[model samples]
Target: MRAFAAAAIGLTAAVALVLTVTAIGPPQDGTSPEPLLTTVPGPKK
Candidate 1:
């Protein structure tokens, strides 16, 4: 049925995504090299 086909497609996509991310693994460093902006800047004079 169409519902079954859709479910299979979703499952396959999810598995592929998990495998890809697993292979890539996490970053070596705990933190990022570039600093992340946390606050908005004030208006310039």
Candidate 2:
């Protein structure tokens, strides 16, 4: 019973770590604070 509980806890922690890492995603090719929002601004209509 203790082993089962430990396995469950380890699995949960592993899944959470994977999700957190993926959620943050890879770093962009820039040094900006917010890379996605730091692209060249588009021309106004």
Best model per TM-score: 1
Off by over 4 Å in 1: 32-45
Candidate 2 Cα misplacement greater than 4 A, ranges: 30-45
TM-score: model 2 vs. ground truth: 0.60
User: Clashing residue pairs, candidate 2?
Assistant: none
lDDT by residue (tens digit), candidate 1, 1-45: 999999999999999999999999998878867988899988999
- Name the top lDDT candidate: 1
Error of 1 at 22 (Å): 0.2
Lowest-lDDT window of 10 residues in candidate 2?
30-39
TM-scores for all candidates: the values are 0.63, 0.60
Flag clash pairs in model 1: none
